[model samples]
Structures are given as structure tokens and as C-alpha cells.
Target: MTVTEQTFWVVIPAAGVGSRMQADCPKQYLELQGKTVLEQTLAHFTHHPRIHGIVVAIAEDDDVWPTLKVNTDKPLYTVNGGAERCHSVLNALNFLKDKTRDSDWVLVHDAARPCLRREDLDKLMITMAQHPQGGILAVPVRDTLKRVDVACIIEDTVDRERLCHALTPQMFHIGMLREALEKAIDEGVLVTDEASAMEHAGYSPLVVEGHGDNIKITRPEDLALADFYLASISDEAASDYDGLMADDG
Candidate 1:
């Protein structure tokens, strides 16, 4: 099917407690730019014209989601998350099985990643809209790498030429992804990301380049960085708006 004929959906896995953050609640629930991290992350898709719907996988005892003020006219649903991120994604797929066709696209994103740029999202959609395997937003590895052993000693300098940091919003066909995840999980394979599951199933997914600012909130320092990025993004938008008004006048 063509791009316009395809329906795009999003799945957010937000059940993790984020023990690394050492916070009172999950990192997704932590306040960022006067809103929860998950809320900020959802805004990118909820306000987008191409997104058909969204499914958020929350913890079984997650009471915070109901209390949040999420403004969206699009179809939004929630399901109880599983032990791991892959399990949660698979659960979301199962929830959408009856509601979507096999060709419909599913973009699985991390709830903690709140700084996904609009251009990156569009690039992923435009590039992979009709692609048979699907694609993801990623950035090239710029920093030098070191292979450390158990004693924290550097064994060797790893090659960074072909390395890329995998970011969220990994897009794929709904039915195909579900089958892949199920197959990987059945054999106790560690399906870290959607693309890995697809790879295990013998499909080469496209990798779309994205900005490095799209970061997952993993530590306290990251919260500060995200806030700064959000502020910068707002300032840029305002400047662009002023420029547009001046041209219109």
C-alpha cells in the first residue's frame, strides 16, 4: 500500500521503575518542563497529523497515569505492561491485533525520551512509510569506544566507524513485528529493541539519521539537559514564528 493508505500507530512502554534515576517514582513520571516526561514524549505524536492512535503500556499498579492531564483528540489506549520492555511492546501489539490491519505501521517509542524532534519523526515516516521491513531514528557514534573487561581494564579500542546509537520510535509493520517478538521471546532470546527482533527474524530494517538531542532520561543530569534542550527548542520556535509574522506583514 501507498503512504497515504497506511495507518500509523505508536506504542509507548512506560512501566519501568527507572531504578537508575533513584527517584520516588518512575523516571517517566518525573517532572520535566513543568510536565511529566511521558506527557512531553506523547505530545510529539498526539499533535501530529499522520498519527492514527497511541497505546501506552503502564505498570500494573500505575496510578499516576490516570491523574495526568493528557490533551489529545486521537484514539489513546492503555495496557498493563510486562516484566521487560520487549514484553510490554508485544503486549501493545496484541492489544492492537484486532484493531489494525497487517499492513498498518507501528512505531514503538520510549516514554522517557521526551526530546524527539519533529523533523526526525517526519524523516523516519517519510523514509520508511512504504518500506517492507521498516526503519528507526538513530545517530552516529561520535565518541571513541573502549572494550572493557570485567576488571574495568580496557582490552582494546573498538571500531566506531559503523556504530550508531539506537534511539526510539523504531517503526515496523504491526503483524510482522508481533510475530518477530513472539518468536524471539519463545526461545529466550534477549530482544533489546524492535530492530533486533526483526534482525533475528532475518529482516534488514532501514536506519534513519536523527539528532542526538533525542535522549532518554536515565539519570539526574539528563533531566537538566532535557530541560535545556526544551527551552532551546521553544526559543527557536518563537524566533521562527516572529520571522514568519514579519514576512506575512
Candidate 2:
């Protein structure tokens, strides 16, 4: 089937209290570009023609999500999140079990990662449309690495070759990812990301290269960085539109 013919869903795990940000509320609720971080993240997928629906796993006691004015005509759902991100993702998958088939694709993204580039997103969907094992957007490790001991001493310089910084919108088949997450949780293994769970299931998902501007808001300073990235993206879009107009003229 063509990429547009396939059903695609987005799952956002927004349950964690980002203590690192040291904010009054959850980092996802923090203000950025005149909207909550989560709001900005949701905007990326809400109007995308390829995205069929969205399921957001929010904290059970999250009172802030209700206050946000999100404008979208697509199917947007909210489920009570779990103690861990894996459980939250599984909950979202289970929530959609009745509505989606085993082959339907689901892209799990972070709520605070609001700066995903349009080109990177388009690349992921187009490249992984027919792929048996779906892929994730990642950037190759460019900096020197170090292995440190508990004492803060650098024991060895690690090789950066073939190493990558995993970014989000990790696309996977619904049934496959659900089963993989269930297996990892049952085994008491701490699978950090969806890719890691799939890895434990013996599937080497493809890694589609993406830009590094897709940053997760972890610290207070990240708000500024995301603001900058968002401005740059807007400027680039405006420039492209101007060029198109010039060509038409």
C-alpha cells in the first residue's frame, strides 16, 4: 500500500514530572512560543494528513491538560499514564487495540520534543512506509565519548563509530510494539525507548538520519533553545514560500 493509504497513529508519553527542568509544573505544561510545550508537540501531528489519530498518556492527576486549548479535528485521545513510560505506551496501544489492526503503524514521541523538523518527519514516513521493521529518526554521534567510573574518572575513551543519538517519532507496528513492550515489562527489563524494546525482541529497526534540532525539553535552558529552533524553522518556511512566489512571478 502507498504511504498515504496506511493508517498512522501517534502516541505521546507525557506522564513524567521533569524534575530536571525544576519548574513549578511538569515540563510539558511549561510555556513555550506562547503555548504549552505539549501543545506545540501536538500541533506537529494534529494537522498532518498522514496521521489518523493521537493518544496522549498523561498523568492520572494531571489537571493542566484539560485547560489547554488545542485546536484539531483529528481523533485525539488521552489515557491515564503509568508509573513508567513503557507502561504508559502500552496503555495507549491497548486503548487503540479495538480501533486499529496489527499492521497499523504507531509513532511514539516525547511530549516535550516540540521542534521536530518537517522534512525529518516526512522522510521517516516515506522511507518506512513499506519497511517490515519500522525505523526511528536518529543522528550519528559526532562528539568524542568517554566511559566514566562512579568516581567521575574517565576510564576509557569509547568509540563513537556506528553510534547514534536516538530521536523520536519511533515508528513501529502496533501489535509488534505492544508485544515487545509487554515482553520487556514481564521480564522486568528496563527498556528506555520503544526502539530498545524492539531490540530486546530481536528486531533491529532501521535508523533514518534526522536533524539534531529535535531536542527534548529537560532543563530550564531548553525552553530558550526550543524557542530558537522554532523561530529558525518558521524563518526557513517563510523563505521557501518567498522563493516559490519569486519563481511564480
How would you encode candidate 1's per-residue C-alpha lDDT over 1-249 as one tens digit per residue? Answer: 545557999999999999999999999999998899999999888867679999999999999999998888999999999999999999999999999998899999999999887767777877787688997999999999999999999999989998999998999999999999999999899988999999999999999999999999999899999998887765321133223222223
Highest-TM-score candidate: 2
Residues 4-121 of candidate 2 have per-residue lDDT tens digits of: 6789999999999999998899999999989999999998888776799999999999999999888889999999999899999999999999999999999999999999976777
* Candidate 2 positional error at 147, Å: 0.8
| Cα-based TM-score, every candidate | 0.93, 0.94
Off by over 4 Å in 1: 234-249
Query: All models: lDDT?
Result: 0.89, 0.90
lDDT assessment of candidate 1 = 0.89
Runs of candidate 2 exceeding 4 Å displacement: 235-249
Report the number of the highest-lDDT candidate. Answer: 2
lDDT of 2: 0.90
